[model samples]
Target: MAEHVLEMKNVTMQFGGVVAVNDLSLEVNKGEIVSLIGPNGAGKTTAFNVVTGVYAPTNGAVYFNGKHIVENYPRGKMKKLYAGTSRGVYTKHIEPTPDVITKLGIARTFQNIRLWKSQTVFTNVLIAKHMRRTSNIFTATFRLNRKEEKKQREETEELLKILGLYEVRDELCTSLPYGLQRRLEIARALATNPSLLLLDEPAAGMNPQETAELTDFIRKIRDDFHLTVFMIEHHMDLVMDISDRIYVLNFGALIAQGTPEEIQKNPKVISAYLGEQE
Candidate 1:
């Protein structure tokens, strides 16, 4: 059996009275590609947010690499100000900040393109490497640690090449085609050197052909990077084509989970997607 890289136990999130995720438990094993699919507002992104520390679950716990990080890091200055405290307060066992969770070897891409639109593609990816860099900002800015900077640059370049964005490395992100921009986002996430990657709607606005290419690209990255991927995507074809396992969510609850073939035949999934069509 593959080693487990992520585990969520009875995770539930409530927005006032509405439950965004309810008693959801799932796992992703090492080097596996898992898909989270559901109708809109099924809490798929909510699950992603919880796992990545965007929102602490209203109930339950999440573990990454066998350790709980839902509330592991110190809260940032802003959170401190808002909460009227400087000391990091653990909220329901959740980590106080997303940065700490990320440092634990998980990274994510947003549903909307979150690239620095003003920056060049290379610059966007280069910035991601900052989180993993050991040198202080002073050294990085002054080029004081030349060896480290060189090593980081080389790694960045290789990642860009792998994502096929090396040719447009110097171009502004806003100027790239939408499909390339999405690829750039994935490349930037890869720059963080994560053990687990959470991609939200990676195929959101691509043509069928582009989506097909992206399917292959995703698999290639999984093998090349040796990382586990948990993705929330609405593109059924892409999800079915690449996922080793599929988890179906509806009304903020998991309704079905199985191999692609099994999920395709699931009555609940059919009802959710097709809505009991005549």
Candidate 2:
């Protein structure tokens, strides 16, 4: 069986009487493309935030590459707001910082493009590559890491070429069109050398033609990098076209999980998203 690159075990996230994710569980296997889809308030982005370690899950465990990256249980101020059944027991709590999460073979792009607007496209990508550098601060301070820097630059250049961003490598990141900027965010995540890539609304703000290009781009990158991709997207065409499996969410709860054809036929998914009537 293919190894699961990511696993969320009965995870729940809540905030002050508001539950964003409730008893959510899913898995993304190696080399597969999976998607999470729902309406705006279905907690899709919150789930990404929890997985990426932006917010600690109120309960349950998250594993990446077979490592327990984020594990949570109710405590002090959170006991009443855990939104799951883990309360009133011995609960383990461990929430790694976002940067720490990035170094552990998983990387993510935000729903909003988060490039360094003032930095050039090449510089932005190169900065992300620094996360994996081996040189010490002292070595970098004395300009003794020239070889390492050169290699990083070379790799970033090659990545830009592969992602079709080399033509604008010297432009300010904010200067690129919206679609290209989104691609740049994906490239930045790839710079972290991740085995798993998480994309939040990668198709947002894209026209049909641009979305089509992005669909092809995503497929090309997966094949080129041998990556496992999990994304949250509202574009039904894009999600159905590229996903090997999909999970649908409604009001922060999972309504269905299946292949595209099965999900399309699932009455729960159809009723939630398509508003199908008898």
Candidate 3:
């Protein structure tokens, strides 16, 4: 059996009185491509946000690699204002920061392209490498650590080449085609050297041909990087073609989960799609 990299147990989130997610539980094993599919307001992105620490779950727990990540930080004004709270009181339970999460082996891309629009393609990726670099900016600015700088540059160039962005490395990100821009975002995420990658709607605006190519590209990257991939995508064909497992969400809850073939035949999925047949 493959090792589980992430686990969510009875996770629920409520915005005031309305529940966004209800007792959601899922797992992604190592080296697997898992796709989360749901209707527009199924709380898919909210689930991602909870897992990535953008929002704390109102109830339940989240575990990554066997460590409990839920409640890593204290909540409420008492904790924030340091009103009689001891320093390091929550230190033992504190989860690592987002940067630490990336460093510890998880990385993600947003639904929208979040690239450095004015920067060169290479620079966009280079910025992600900043997290992994050991040298201080002062040393880099003064050229005091030429070796570390050269190493980082080499790493960036290699990532560009791997993602097929080397030819356009000098171009401004905003000037690239929409497809290339998406690829750049994935490349930037890869630059973090994550063991698990989260991609959000990677084929949102691409033409069919571009989406087809993206399917292959995602597969190749998975194999090459040896990373576990969990994505939320609306493109059914892409999701069915690439994912090893599929999780179906509807109205902020998981309705079905199985192999692609199994999910394709699920009545819940059919109903969720409102009887849209493949």
Candidate 3 per-residue C-alpha lDDT over 236-276 given as tens digits, one digit per residue, 9 for 90 to 100:
99999999999998988889999999999999998999855
Write the residue-wise lDDT of candidate 1 on 1-278 in tens digits: 76889998777776655667777889999889999999999999999988887887666678888887663222343332232121333345554467877788999999999999899999999999988878886886898888977888888899888789999999999999999999999999888889999999999989999999999999998998988999999999999999999999999888999999999999999999889867
lDDT (10s digit) by residue, model 2, range 153-250: 99999999989999999999999999999999999999999988999999999999999999999999899999999999999999999999999999
Clashes of each: 5, 0, 0
How good is model 2 by TM-score?
A: 0.96
How much lDDT does each candidate structure score?
0.85, 0.91, 0.84
Q: List the residue pairs that clash in candidate 2.
A: none
Candidate 3 achieves a global lDDT of 0.84
Q: Judged by TM-score relative to the true structure, which candidate is superior, 1 or 3?
A: 1
Q: TM-score for every candidate vs. truth?
A: 0.89, 0.96, 0.88
- Those runs of model 1 whose alpha carbons end farther than 4 Å from true positions after fitting are 71-92, 137-143
- How well does candidate 3 score on lDDT at residue 189? 95
In terms of lDDT, the poorest run of 10 residues in model 1 is 78-87
Candidate number achieving the greatest TM-score relative to the actual structure: 2
Considering lDDT, where higher is better, how would the candidates rank from best to worst? 2, 1, 3
